[model samples]
Target: MVQLWKLVLLCGLLAGTSASLLDIRGNDVLRRLISGLERGLDTFDSTIEIIFQNLKTELESRCSDEVVEQQETENFLEQLISRIFQVVSRLTGVRIRNVQVPDITFEATSENSANVSIPITADVTVSLPFLGEIVDLDLNVDLQTTVSIETDTDDPQVVVGECTNNPESISLTVLHSRFGLLNDVVDIGVNLARRVVSSVVEGELCPRFRELLESLDAECVEKLIGESQDTTQQEPEGRR
Candidate 1:
């Protein structure tokens, strides 16, 4: 259950890595990075919905029990719900609608350091089941983070890496929902949310990003080798 919470938070904050910053030429790199982030978040939302349904079912079952027959079960359910609420309370939103990630700009600072900046806008609904109310919470957030890129010894052209985001310094703007403004209330848990998100980014997301970089690097190497072979094969024996 604790691990699940970490995953939930990771779905919110993202990560990555690379080599001495290569001059990023086209939108391809940014496109690929955002694609992974979007996919991770989409999966997160679906997984949460599934979990919510499962938990709701369990709660209903516990509540349906005969009072005297399952006193212990009732007690356990109460404690579980309380803990669950505490976890949910720290999140700013419960459901995400549209996510718009603007073009990302990346610059390599050194062989081991690279920085990326992007603006993300999203529409989300905040549901407080414990309070029996749901509210809209739109957001505009600025993301700035650094990644560590290491060159593979066997293949120096291939870079392996990981990223750590400065969540504590992330700029976030919460807009009023149609229902009302809840920033004051949500602000109370903003730091908590940031901390949880940071943990996931550093732990799970970073490793996954590293894997992605490695995979891309492998594909590039294969393509180059194939092209070289084709070029050699095309040469005439007379030239030799």
Candidate 2:
């Protein structure tokens, strides 16, 4: 009778062990998914950094000379404003004087969001009609924007769906413009330029970020899922 009881207990233990294997496998798969996501985000962040750095380099090369030369332009204030308006008409060649291209930095806020901060400093030369030499109008700009990440509702396999940027804080400053009669004019122009640049950057980044994230998602998921399946298949083979 005691041997019969022992046999029953052994079977119960074996059944309990078998039942828990599925739960263990599921937990492992979850771990792998999380790990894959973390790696994907890291790669995304690095790629964005490289892209921004390249942009900064390109802007410095392309616009720096044109801007610095604007200080030497005759009747710079009149010509610059006219140039700005003309460019706005065609939507091209809108340049700022003494231009310093901003360096962009991104920090991940969550699995699907990030914060971007860009700081900029430059000089806008305003040539008084009566004064031959220009006023070295300093510009300081601080731009902060938040990006949201979401999965595409229509495509479950397409992990990265949309990137939306929240309108953020923009601070513009013109240093030492207190003595001039054109102080208000310069301030207004500087603030306007800040807004234009901020909008352009936000618009460009959101779509690009969405595309990059989407590209990463499918491959990341595939690799992780494939590894999990391989591990599961090997487990039964090991037992055999």
Listed per candidate, the RMSD to the true structure in angstroms reads: 23.1, 30.7
- Per-residue lDDT of candidate 1, residues 53-103 (tens digit): 444454334324356443433233223222322333333233444555444
Residue 10 of model 1: what lDDT? 56
Residue pairs whose backbone atoms clash in candidate 2: none
Per-residue lDDT of 150-222 in model 2, one digit per residue for the tens? 4576544534434433334444445544325443344434444454444443444344434433444433434
lDDT of each: 0.40, 0.41
Q: Quote the positional error of residue 5 for candidate 1 in Å.
A: 41
Residue 150 deviation, candidate 1, in Å? 6.2
Ten residues in a row with the worst lDDT in model 2?
A: 73-82
